[model samples]
Target: MKKPLVIAATLAVVLSLGLAACGGDDSSEETLSNSELIAQADQICTDYNEQLDTMNEEAALDENSSRQEIATYISDDLVPLYQEQVDELRSLNPNEEDAAAYNDIVDTLESELQVVEDDPEAAIDAEDP
Candidate 1:
């Protein structure tokens, strides 16, 4: 994928994962303070970034890999990773103040991920208007 789109997709994954890691249980009346939520979310992103960095490093080692191979890897691996993040985010049941923004992010990421899953090569090759 183009650098910008790749960055955007990565960011979407980070944010979604952060939101997903927050919490999912509805029985608890306790809610995290905004600062606490931010801290937790940041930690989740940090961990995910580290994992992604490793994956990128491995991909980079294969100098002879074709665009199709890269796209296939992304579709097979990253798309499901993004989807897992989305699923986790949905389970969070975020508060009203953050729900709208979180939902928007999740929706955009899910749609983009779907496009990648359907046709990874086209997604990588697509140009911005």
Candidate 2:
């Protein structure tokens, strides 16, 4: 079965990914304004979504594809992509006004990704997934 877990996890990840629109670190010598931070985050989100869409196209799972195949796609493809997106977002410096919110978003995403990683099968079989 294609399974609801895959669909549900995908939805959760997409929603959480969108919230990754602001973050901060001390990497840059110059601080970015809130607007600039938002713009950069937006670009990151756009890039992530584009990449996800491309991966989905490339995966092209059929009805005959096994559950393990779907789970592997999530673990091998989705997880790494999400981790990269999170890392990119974390590298950006959000203004003080947006710092807390940005951290919360990243934290939530990390936790969600953990759940998906801990048990790909369970995630695929989640009742509410």
TM-score versus the correct structure, for each prediction: 0.64, 0.78
Question: Candidate 2 lDDT, tens digit per residue, 1-119?
Answer: 54433554464554455454553444586666777777777777777778877777788876676888888887887778888877887787777778778777877777777777777
lDDT of 2: 0.69
> Looking at model 2, which ten-residue stretch has the lowest summed lDDT?
2-11
**Native-to-model Cα distance after best TM-score fit, residue 98 in candidate 1, in Å:** 2.0
The residue-by-residue lDDT of candidate 1 on 3-120, one tens digit each, is 5336335545534543543433222355444454455455555565676666666656253557767676677666666676556544444565665665676677577678777876
Candidate 1 ranges beyond 4 A from true positions: 1-34, 61-63, 126-129
lDDT of 1: 0.56
User: Against the true structure, whose TM-score is highest?
Assistant: 2
Where model 2 places Cα greater than 4 Å from the true spot, the runs are: 2-26, 126-129
**Native-structure RMSD, model 2:** 3.3
* Candidate 2 clashes between residue pairs 3 or more apart in a chain or in different chains: none
